[model samples]
Target: MLLSIDWIFIIEKCILIAVIIGISLVVAMYETWAERKVAAIMQDRRGPNRAGVFGILQPMADGLKLFMKEEIIPNLSNRFLFVLGPGLAMLTAMMTSAVVPWSSHLDIKGRMVSLQVADINIGILYIFGVVSMGVYGIMIGGWASNNKFSLLAAVRGASQIISYELAMGLSFIALLMLTGTLSLRTIVEQQQDHLYNFIYQPLGFFIFLICAFAECNRTPFDLSEAENELNFGYHQEYSSMKLGFYLFAEYVNMFISSAVMATLFFGGYDIPFVNDISFGQQHGQNVLAILQGLSLFVKVGVFIFFFMWVRWTIPRFRYDQLMRLGWKILIPLALINMLATGFIILLRNNGWHL
Candidate 1:
């Protein structure tokens, strides 16, 4: 009986992994479609609608084109590391979802079903650790390419990510103090009673949000991939699926980051006033679990749309200005925010709860 139970557990885990990966890929593909549509509207032009109804099939067509294209390797490049770079980029982007708490567990036929792939105690730390490592992919790829422009772009990209990560980490410190736990599940649970951290920590939220844009290389922070200056930037020397991986990994990273932001500051899967509804109470546990899952997707979708909207609306930041924003502005602001939060929390604990 123990062996049978172990087998069942393994099967369930495998199924969960498959579902998350499949959904992530689909979301990444459609993000590309949505981005193009958004750009077209901003530019006052009709976007890709020729391929299928509302241009829904354009991603598939683009995939086929990329697959059929010739794979190129420059003679001077380190072929192995060149290939490994994009693979690492894609892998790190996908790996971040492993710890995100999508929903509370479901009760199914006396068996508990976990909504997350892995509910490690240090889930938020795991996200930060993994995301910090993503810069290596771009750095390695650019350095291995043996091209001056690629190397320059890679250095810029590395510097930007590292600088912004400091502000991002500081922002999380305020949330950590409030929740008193690094586990994302516990953080989400804490928000169910009163308010989201975003309401209390608006300054930190704004800092983190802007830092996220820099980390993801989105405009007005896409200095690393500025086309006119760097000629397509770090992945400039790549072609075929290799180049595709770098680009695809970008959108995937954006989707994952948006999900993380939503989970962290926006209360994950908890809808406002949802506890007052009878549907959540009268229904069985399984039904409530499904509703929670739906809530998470809706939140994630809104965040994704906000990402595209900002990308289209903002202009790229100049390189020096980007550096100044990170080091001179955001860092100092984040430090002040952290100190204030700590002071408030201390006062509250002494019967002066604000």
Candidate 2:
């Protein structure tokens, strides 16, 4: 019986992993389609409707093109690391998904199946670590390419991520104080019972949101790939599927970052104005699980749209301006937010709790 149970557990987890990873890829694919449609709408032109209805098949077509394109390796490049670069970039982007709780557990035949891949105690830190490591993809590829422009782009990307991650970590300190736990599950649960983090940590959320954009290398902070200056930047010499891997990784990062924001600030999978935790106990767990999961994705979709919107709306920031914003503006704001949160928590603890 124990062996049977263990096999069942393994199967359940395998299914969940496949579903989440598949969903991430599918969402990433459509985000490219949506981005073009959004850009077309903004520019008052028809978007990609030629391939399939409303360009639904455009991503597949693009993928096929990438696969069919002639693979190129610059004669001077480090062949192994050149290959490792995109793979590493793609790996780091997907790694962040392991800790995200997609929804409350579903009750299946008296066994609870968790929607998350992993419930690591230090989920947020895991996300931070993986995201920080993503720059290595660009760095490795650029250095391997034996191209000066690519190397420059890699350095810019590395510097930009490092600068923003500092403020990002500082921003989270305020929320961490309120939740008092590093676990993403705990954070989500606390929000379900109490108020969402954003309600109390608006300033922290603002700082985090901006840093997230910077972390994902979105416009207004995408100086790393500034075309005119860097000549297509890191991966400039990459071709075919390798280039596709780099582009695909960006969209994946954006998707995961959006999901992270949704989980942290938007109450994750908690259904609003309802006691979903209690409702699950009284009602059917399966239904509640689905609804809660849907709620989380709804929030994620909104964030993704917001990301694309900002890309079309905002101009890219100059390198100096980007560094100044991170160091001078965002870091100071995050520090202040953290300090204030600590003071408030102390006050509430010492006879100030209502």
Candidate 3:
């Protein structure tokens, strides 16, 4: 029965997975380099120009350094969970990309092949579930380290992520109501026929964007890793490549978050102001697919740069302030946005009748 099954499809999916993972790792690696360069430009200093021209090889050098570093596991730590922590973080970071629609379909030997790995019905929900699981990685790593500071940071991270997720889910409710579908590809298709969801749900988008920062443990919301307070935060006891995995997972999460934001609010692979179907007809399906892929990456790149820019420009938020903003402010706003969206949708369905 297995042999009779469509092995070609399985092979194609495996290849796609490999390609996507490769691309993600490459992007995450360079994000470290880009972060430094952005900081340099903003701070008016040379960032990294030693390893190669403009220090293009710096990320490789850094990776090599991490690989060569001594791996040290605390004697008091849980050996199994200690090793699993960063691996889980890296795994969850990459998992979220499975549902993201990278581009329009590619015509491969008269077959229409989707660029996305899985066009699941509940793509958004899958993202949320995976993102929520990401906290477990931090929590386990912190707890297993057998350090008070690590535990405290982990607790802080867990609380912060949980608090903001309420606002994030509520904000997404408004978008789901607007799109009327859980499938991400369908949502992108719907946007192609109309204005981007951002126009309709700017407040929701704002809330989601803020929540995304918190979710990814990025600046202003990066209370868990507050250097001054927690002494480098949850992974304090970690060293070598394990520590590298935790840090590298962060950039991967950032990349995925940027892609999600771009897909949900900005139209995933759609070229702005260009009629995609017409272009595909004018050119070819494969050519069009390539351009659309480039378009999506460009959007993702812009968001990634914005993430780096904000990190350099904004300081980390106080824990109290972060909690207050997430619970008191963003939650209420998200609820209001959801209610207002539903009300508007109901009215439009009834021709604006009372």
Candidate 4:
């Protein structure tokens, strides 16, 4: 029975999962430093340069501070749900990475190993489902706090996410119309041989990007956390590592969202203007895989920078404006884009048939 089990595959997957989790955590950590640095540059001030060379160690210091801080649970709060909120948020954030193809497959010894944790057929759907659950964390935490402000912030967050998700899903439907596959790995593979989806689905990508901003609770859609309105927002009652978990989850979600956007719209791990397969044949699979992984990371980095840039540059939207944009504007645009994509695909298919 032991011999029948593919131990090598299991071990490979385990290692991949651990590496991915580590990478996600590290990226999330540095994103805080990057955010501050970017803000300082935009504001013409020094950020966190005191700690370890241009503030590179600032995130570590911040983590240590959070760890040392007292863990406080509000007296009136529901203890079980209060603890569960941040845990659920962090879990959902990490879970999204399971389906993301980090790079092309790497050949280990004689066997080919995929970089993705679970390249399930319903990869995109899995992401949507996980993201949908993330809102529950906010709601539970806020309601458990037994604070009216926290409950209001949670309500705002849940509504914002729900509103934008409709447009985001609709935008994805247009991409699905083009790709005809739900598998993210397959989408990237297709793009390797052709133009990236962004070129073909520009409108869809635009809608998706805007919806992505809203989904991540980034400004100009960050009404839920508007300091003037909600104080500290849904996680207001959390302290110590529990509060850190909520903060970390947001950054992790941003990183994963960047990766997902890169994979969907850009040629994920596909070296631009380079025939990866031929290059791999000329060089070796390991070298090619490393380059591919770097390529994906580079794209992800650019997207993350863009996210930070917009957050610093833009102002938060009014609650009414956010709802209007999501329901009235984005949804209609997404619907039209989806219809147009279908029409174009139908025409092309008929032309090919003729």
Best by TM-score: 3
lDDT of 1 by residue, 127-164 (tens): 89998999999999999999999999999999999999
TM-score per model over all chains: 0.96, 0.96, 0.98, 0.97
Q: Which should have the higher TM-score, number 1 or number 4?
A: 4
The residue-by-residue lDDT of candidate 4 on 1-354, one tens digit each, is: 547887888999999999999999999999999999999999999999989999899999999999999999999899999999999989999999999999988888888999999999998999889989989888999999999989999999999999999999999899998999999999999999989999999999899899889888887887767777558899888899999998899899999999999999998889898999999999999999999999999999999999999999988888898899989999999999999888888888887541
Residue 110 CA displacement from its true place in model 4, Å: 0.8
Give candidate 2 regions above 4 Å deviation.
Answer: 1-5, 281-283
22 Cα displacement, candidate 4 (Å): 0.3
lDDT of 4 at 351: 79
What candidate 4 gets wrong by more than 4 Å, as runs, is 1-4, 352-354
Q: How many residue pairs clash per model?
A: 0, 0, 0, 0
Deviation from native of the Cα of residue 282 in model 1, angstroms: 1.3
Which of candidates 2 and 3 is the stronger one according to TM-score?
A: 3
Residue pairs of candidate 2 with colliding backbone atoms: none
2 against 4, candidate with superior TM-score: 4
Q: Residue 328 in candidate 3 has what lDDT?
A: 95
lDDT of 3 at 192: 90
Judged by lDDT against the true structure, how good is candidate 3?
0.93
Using lDDT as the measure, name the better of candidate 1 and candidate 4. 4
**In candidate 4, which residue pairs clash?**
none
